[model samples]
Target: MSDHFLMFVPTDPTWQPTKADAERAVELFKSIAPNAQTIEAIFTDDVEFHHPCENWSGVDCAACGADLEDWFYETTDKVYRENHFADLSVTTPCCGLHTSLNDLNFVWPAAFGRFALESMRPGLDTNEEQEKAIAACLGSDLRKVWIHL
Candidate 1:
């Protein structure tokens, strides 16, 4: 069994929405996606590593087309082990080019005061239009992350 998650995070890395903002965003999301549920920000300090692909299997170095699974695994291990919440920047072994983890299209998880909304349904597409509405309510641009687990 697997679960799919579409997470929306603030575009500004340092922005954290207030409780009122979250509530408003939730209402906006509910208007368009009636099935979405409000999920309390559990991993408040955890920043997501998102790839363009749906699953980790398709991850590769942009410069050289080399597989990045091992690198991603290692990085995941380090982040969880160290409880690191700061942005991650690394040099790909394949091409030795510098890239910030944010550059790879990852969504930074909502911080302590903010809230994240989620919907768990197989094969549900990330509704960009709805996301934009929520972001507009929150007064910020949002970054979307699709997780298949």
Candidate 2:
């Protein structure tokens, strides 16, 4: 079975909204995607990566645009095992430049954050203005990720 999710994650990897703000954002998203089967905000103790699941295409080096899918998996695994993603710092394998797993260019628009607002099976798409409103409710800029799994 496969499911689709529309998720909004904070741009800052370690940012988390207050429970009240998260609840408000959930309500706003529900209003925007009224027919969605479920809508909620997920809070975590440490920064976690949110990928587009089966919708993922691949990733590229943010600095040089080199394909970095293999590097991404290796690096993310490294950090996840090291500290469950509590720290996201790293050096780009392709360019030897300093960066982080969260800073890489994910082709399918993934993000790392301690907070995420997600809508499951929403037969709806939000316009820019609506998106901004939800972001305001969360008090943070957001990156939208479409996930299929």
Candidate 3:
């Protein structure tokens, strides 16, 4: 992987509808379906480890549709040998590492890189700012070194 990642959005509305809402809950849900569908479209291909290609020389693989299985397996092995079982479990499919976020196009590293984008949250008081802060917390240094024994 080239250390690039993408961001994904949730298809379903995370919050519940309030009483007396003009649009029925079902209609709102139906509306969100398209957004979710778009998200899915973004992640059409797996983030695989590929050799160099003609168009993008020196790039290991196409960031959009690369298969991450090898990387995941190697990473799992490396972490296991290093005795990091907890991290290993988190990366495993049984743990939902691949589909955890649902949207596939969001590159793991790039999406995670949002935190490293800045030293601290730009705005901390507002809800959006707070949410970004939280994401930054989880995003920084999400990468792990693959060790071979």
Worst 10 residues of 1 by lDDT: 105-114
Local accuracy by lDDT, each model: 0.56, 0.89, 0.28
- The better-scoring model by TM-score among 1 and 2 is 2
State, as a TM-score between 0 and 1, how close model 1 is to the true structure. Answer: 0.68
* Model 3 superposed RMSD (Cα): 15.5
Question: Candidate 1 local accuracy as lDDT?
Answer: 0.56
Tell me each candidate's TM-score.
0.68, 0.96, 0.20
Clash totals for all candidate models: 0, 0, 10
- Minimal lDDT window, size 10, model 2: 93-102
Would you list the rank order by lDDT, best first?
2, 1, 3
Candidate 1, superposed: residue stretches over 4 Å from native: 12-14, 37-43, 46-54, 105-115, 122-127
- Candidate 3 minimal-lDDT segment of 10 residues: 112-121
Of 1 and 3, the candidate ahead on TM-score is 1
Q: What are the runs in model 2 whose C-alpha is more than 4 Å off?
A: none
The C-alpha local distance difference test score for the whole of candidate 2 amounts to 0.89
